[model samples]
Each structure stands twice: as C-alpha cells, then as structure tokens.
Target: MGGPPGPFSVPLRLSPKVLLIDPVRMLPSLLVPLVGVLVVGGFSPRSYLWAAFGLVGTVVFALIRWATFTYEIAGDRVEIKRSLISRSIRTIPLERVRGVDVSTPPMHRLLGLAVLKIDTGASGGDGEATLDGVTVGEAERLKPLLLRRARTEATPTARPEEERHAEGVPSERVIFAVPRRWLLYGPLSGAYLLTPFALAGGAVGLAFQWGDDLGFGRNAAWSVGEWLWQRPSLLVAAMVLLIVAMPIAGGVMYAVFNWDFRLKRRDGYLVAERGLINRRSVSLESRRVRGYEIVDGLAERWAGVVRAWAIVTGLGDSETRGQLLPVVPRADATAVTGDAIGPYQAELRPHPPIARNRRLFRAVFPWLVPAALAGLLLLLTGLTVWWVLLVVSLVMAALGVPLGLDRYRSLGHGYDGDRVAVRSGSLRRSTAVVERRAVVGWRLHQTWFQRRAGVLTLTVGAGAGKGGYSAIDVSEAQGRDFPAEVTPEWLAPFLNPPPGPHTPSDPPSTG
Candidate 1:
C-alpha cells in the first residue's frame, strides 16, 4: 500500500494477503496436474516433491503479479498499470462506472480482506475490473467514493444530499431484509435442488477412484452391491433418503447464499448485502434503475413466494447482479419493489379470446407429430408397446391443454403513469414494469398464423433488464397502438400519422 500523492493519484498494490488468497484460488486448478504427477510416479511418496514444486511455482507467479500490478484513481478515470517486462495500462472512466461489488471469499474473510469489482457496463471482457484483495476497510471506503464520483460525473446538476435534506428525509432507509422463514421457499423455486445430486455424484466418483488407488475398489463395490442385493428393502430406503435429502440440501444452499440478505436505500444508491461464507455487497446507482421485475417460478408461485430483480440499465448478467428481493412472499416483494422503483399499478388488459386458441394450438402442436407416429406404429406392428406409446403421447398432448391455458392466462400488458408492465410465461412467470422513458424502441411481430389469428406480439425494447418484454398474442391493433400510447412522442408520429394529403381518385385527372 502507498499514501496518495495528491487527492487519489498514488499507485497502490493489493494487500499482501492477496499472495495467500491467489494461491488458495489456484489450488483447484493444480489438482489435475498434481494427480497426473502422482500417477506417473506410480503413486509413490516421491511424487510429493513434484507437487511441492508446482505449489512453489504458483506462489512465485502470484508474487510477480502482485508486484507488477498497481491501481489508482487519477483525475476522471481509474488506472491499472501492470507488467514488468512490457508495461501495460488500462483506464476506466469514472462516468462509465455503474456499480461497485465488494465480496469476501472464505479465505479473504478469514484474513479480513475483500475483493473489489468495478462494473463499467461493457458487454465484453467479464464486464468488470477486479482487484483481487484489499483490506475490508479500504474496500468499504473505495465503494462509496468511487460511486459518488461516478454519479457526480454522470449528473453534475444532481445533489442527492441536498434533495434528501430539503425533503427532510433520512440519509439511509432499510428497505427489505430476508426472514429466516423465507429460506424454505428455496426448494420450491427448485433453483438449488440439483446441487446435492451434483455434489454426491462428484463425491462418489472421487471415492471410487481413491478406493481403486488403494487396491480395494472391487472388494468395496462387491460388498456394497452384495449387501443391497441381500436386503432389497434397503434400495427403497435409500431412495426415500435421497428424496428427503434433495430438498434439505436445497434449503441449506439457499440459506448459505442468502443468509442475512438485506436491501437498503443509502444516499442515491440501492445497496444489497448477502451471503454466508462468501459475503457480498453490491451498490447500484439508483438513477440507473428503470424498472423492477417480479418473477414467479411455478412452484414458488404455488407456494405464494416470489423474487424480484431491479431492471437496471447496464447491470451485469451475473446471477445475483440485480437481485433485489429473494424468495419473499408476494406482498413483501410488491412492497419492496413499489418503494424502490415507482409502483406498477396498471391493471393488465388480457389478450383477446382468439389468442387463447393460438396458445393452445402452439402448446399441443409439437406433441401431435409424435402422437401420430406412435398411432401409425401401433397400427403397423400391432404391438402392445406401440399401443402404450400411443396412449402416452395422447396423454402428454392432453397435458399441453392446461399449460396453454395457463400461458394465455399469464399474458397481459398495461401502462400506468410513467410505467408500462407486461406479464408472460407459465413455468417462470415474470412481470416486468419499465419506466416509459427507459423504452428505446418498439417492435411488432406477426407470424403468418398470428396474422391469420388476428393477433401480434408487441415487444417493448428498453435499455435495461432483458432488453425487451413482449405482450404475446395480443390483438393486432393493440400491439400497434400500445407503443404509441406508452411513448407517444417516439412512436405516435410514425404509427398514427396526421391525415395523409387528400388525393381524389378521378378528380385529379379531371382537374
């Protein structure tokens, strides 16, 4: 570390602890190479020397990297200088800074260090610049200062402090904090259900490999198989144990990731903090937030829980990038989102009845070909299996009826005040509400069948979130008119042009 020569001009290296953290991070990558060396050495203790050599190399590389890399906030940009043999410099403009993420991995947390990531909203190159390890205090200090300067550069006229004081508002407000009970909603969302299976699969593979190395693989496998074969009931018991373990594992994972999750409004930013072993803090510019999305996975919806994400312009596409609320009750999600971005109060206008037919047709269409094939097979072969296949296909196609109806029921769009909202999907239903000003363009899509059905899909193109939201299978007129209604100044002129100059059919020639 070095003292600033001017305001923030002194080049400073990462904390010394980074040397330790970097090696620990590289440990996983070293596993394959270390194992190969052991295999080549006939699994003898002599291979330990080769492993030690590789570990030393990793340390040396980390040390060189630490010695070479230096960063500083100079003038209007953050500069990163590296390379001893051939110098290289990378600069990120302060005005482009949209968010700052501070995270502490387990190793860093133990050492009281944090990692700082500066998000500049670039679509390429990991979308952020990372400082491997810094003192926790330094990270905390850097986050606000960097964001404040960036916010200042972006909007010179805005005075967040003055505005708050003028309105007699507190500087900080707690928006939402996850409750312990909400962790149960995790398994319902089905996000982490496969985690236990994945871990068990890897662990089983490793265990068998280790047994093989010990020359007991066949004995162990035969013993387990013989034991299970002797007690057939044990198989059913094992299945039941697995059935119970998956949800428990999913809940555990959800708790770990979302432990102590909190969302707060501080100054002019939305700050989120969460995680158990690897703590994370993300600070996003409030002004860049254009909308909010309330998502309902099928099971989560049935359980009356939902998650919310901030539709922030330039937010990264990472898993937790713009997450605002996680697996909370519908009421809680609604309240938090309402307070963050302006509330979405518009009552959605459902699509015309004809759209329902379209949805049902689309849902069942794919199954029809397979069902027909099965029917033909059964007729040609007169086989019982083909008959079963035919029956299964029909049943599957029948299942699509309810799915299509549910999808149609989910589709709707409405606009209220400065916000437009669209809802769609069945399995992972999402209701996105975006500010009118955030919408950059409008698109109307009509397939041949959609046109024949007198409906079209209206895509609302915005600069945030998934970039666009569609009101599927709406009336053609509604699809064309919705954009004009939402952003009249941008689309009305082209869509609803002033009466064209009158041209008489025969009178022009006569004149």
Candidate 2:
C-alpha cells in the first residue's frame, strides 16, 4: 500500500474548480541531499545515479498519494479526504467552525503557498488544526467560502433584508502597528553596542589560534596577558565604554523592531500585523476574547509604556495559552481594550484591595532580614553588643510602617453588573476581570493567624480550563458575608457551606 497521501491525483473533479498546487517547487525539499553530493564532487559519477533515483522515487510517491488528498464543499458540510494507506476520511459540519486563519511563512511565500488553520472552538480541542502547502491564491478564495458557509449555516432562517444587510456590512477589523522610534531605540541599538565586545572576544581567540599555527608551544597565555597589560588603560576605558553603551543600543533596537505597530479595528474583529525583516498578520473575532490585561515593568512603567494582552479561551495551546496581544504603549491600552471588548468594557472592573496582601513585606521591608542578621553577627563579634537587638527591632518597625502604607495604597477592587474585578501587585500591577456567571463555586477560610487578626481569605472557582481565584485576605467579617453577596443563588448550591452546629441534633449514642 502507498504510505500516505502526497499531492498528485485529482479526486472527484466536481468543484468550483480543482486547482492543482504546483508540485515542482515542493519537490526541492526532498532532493537537496542528492544535489549536495553532486555539488561537493563526492563520487561525482555516482551522483547522477542517486539524483535520478531520488527524483523518480519521489514523483511516483506523489502521484499515487495525490488522489487521497481531496476536499469537497457539498452543501454545509466540508468533507476532507486524506491519507493513502489507512484512508481516513472526516467531515466537519460548517456550523461548528468557529474561525479560520491563513499564514504564509518565508518558504511558503517563495512558492506562493499558504497554510490555512481552522479553529472549531473549545469542542474541537485546545486550538486549531492546520492544512499547509496550499497555494496562496486558493487559500484566499477558500476563506470567503468558509466564512459564508459558516455564517449561513449558523443562522440559516434569516430574512432576505437581514441577509442583504449582513452581506453589505463590513466586518470589524483592528490593526496593531508599533511606533518606529520605539523599535529603533529598543533592541537594534543594543545589538550595535554589543558588537564591540564580541569583536574583542573574537580577536583574543584568533590571537591564540595564530600562536598555535606558528608553533608557539603553549606560551600563548603569557603573550595574551602581556598584550592586555601593555594597554591596561585602554582596556579599562573600553570596558567602561561598553558598560555605558549596551543599554542605549538596546533601546534603539526595541524602537526599530516595534515601530509603526498599530492595532486597528474593523467590523467585529481585531487584526495584528508586525515584524521588520519578516511580516506577519493575524485576525480574531471580538466575541472570542475572554479577558485582557495591561502589563508594565519598572522601566516600562516609568516610560509610560503599557503592554496589552488578552485571554482567548480556545485559540491557544499549552505553549501559547492566554497570549492574545503583544506589548503596546500604555496610553493605547484603554482605547484598544474598550474597542475590542465592546459593551463588555463596562464589566472590566479594577482589582480589589485584598489583592495587595503580598506587597506588605515584598515592597516595604525587603532589607529587614539582611539588616537584622548583619546586626546580630556584629553583636556576637562583640561590636555594639548591648544595643544591637534594640537597634534592629527599631529599624524593622520603621520598615514595617511604610510596608503597611504601600500595601494599603495598592489594594482595590470593583465590579460591574455582570463581572467582578480584582487588582493587586507590588512592583508590577495586574487587574483581572471575571464574569459573574463564569464563577462556579467559592470558599472562605480563616487561618489561626488571620482569625486572631480578624481577617479571613476568599477563594473563587470558575469553569474548567480557567484558573480559580487565589486566597485573598480580607477582614474576617467581610469574608463571612462576601460569598453570599458576590455569588448568585444558582452558584450558592455548588459552594461548600460554612461549618456550623447541626440544626437537627443527633440522638445521644446508646452505649
């Protein structure tokens, strides 16, 4: 039996048209080794024999299998016939198709081919499956057909006017383009400054190689040291120069690579296109967006650059889960988020105050342990022994004061009618919004330490495939009442009820 399908035979020729992808260009990837032998002059006479064998073998394989790779657009079902030996055939109902994406990599671009990926939402698995090595033009034509079929099948009983309006209306679209200056300043400049250190390191290695070639007999190390010593001042100056140059260079590179990055909105979708050497474009529907967040590092924060990203439910796998947008300017985050999420933007709540619990020690008293240990060691060494403990305690208290203040400053939360929002971070800030209906369960716990302090923690659980709410500390009084108030009555049954005395006391056990 033939091993598997190779694009060759035309199967079931009934179609808008059966467009045969050019196979000659694809044949190169299979023939490179044979060509390599002839070019390298290794057994030149035998090279022709190998090349001929390779070509004929590949062609025969392609022809036998091509008949198995066929796609028939019959009514609303897309029948994909693939495989050669086992001959597996599958059909995807048009109504279940969620979205389609088309990508053209550099190699595919050269051959005018494109890869079409179809995402059938969560039911289809983690993400989409791809059909690659199709002609670019054919893939483009297939997009509209798939989209039309999906839309019609999804809502087949629409009125004639509604159908006409749907056809006439343009789809919502958004483009993500980075500003040119930022890209030039960020990563490009960094590479330029780093080149010098690389050059110097290369020169040192080459000098050792030259010594070996001239039969210097292992004295190259001393020669290398002597060379450096002779230019000690110059060496020191060069080291200082590089230390100052790298960051500047890095900034330029970041600016150049990210320049002209723009996210545009059209119809009901968001489209992202980026890259300097190689361009890429991607599009996704707005309804598929589960949530989005803004991220900022210290430098990015001070520079007022905020990166925006989204949590798309079924579009990503383990490696790419929850990554929707790349980093963009902080100023653009709000506008872009609002546009993409539509009316749901109102449900985008800020984080609650309890989320700031971790920041109390992390940000406020980072040096407390180190400082106390140093004082204790000095005291044990008989230096300032009497006052060391008192001094350390006082210093720790001073640090704790500010820690508490900043913790309070960073804590906050809000809720829209249908969604809950929580915000918390120390050096970095993050805000999360979860739909109320998405919450499947919740719990309230009180640890001994928290109970003594009159505080308790709350945890919220959502649907599978989404992370649950972590233990967030809040006033014990507030915790007892939070679950009942935040969770709907429908979800209340799913929650573990608070422990209490049995209303119907059990009869005393008979001995």
- Give a tens-digit lDDT track for model 2, residues 105-161: 666666576667666655434334455666777776666555553233323534343
Candidate models: Cα lDDT each: 0.83, 0.54
Worst 10 residues of 1 by lDDT: 150-159
lDDT (Cα, tens digit) per residue for candidate 1, span 58-101: 99999998999998887667788989679999888777888888
Model 2 stretches with alpha carbons more than 4 Å out: 1-74, 77-81, 121-127, 147-168, 172-178, 182-267, 318-325, 343-358, 362-410, 443-471, 477-486, 491-511
Report how far off residue 404 is in candidate 2 (Å): 8.6
C-alpha TM-score for every candidate: 0.87, 0.61
Model 2, position 391, has a per-residue lDDT of: 73
State, as a TM-score between 0 and 1, how close model 1 is to the true structure.
0.87
Error of 1 at 483 (Å): 1.7
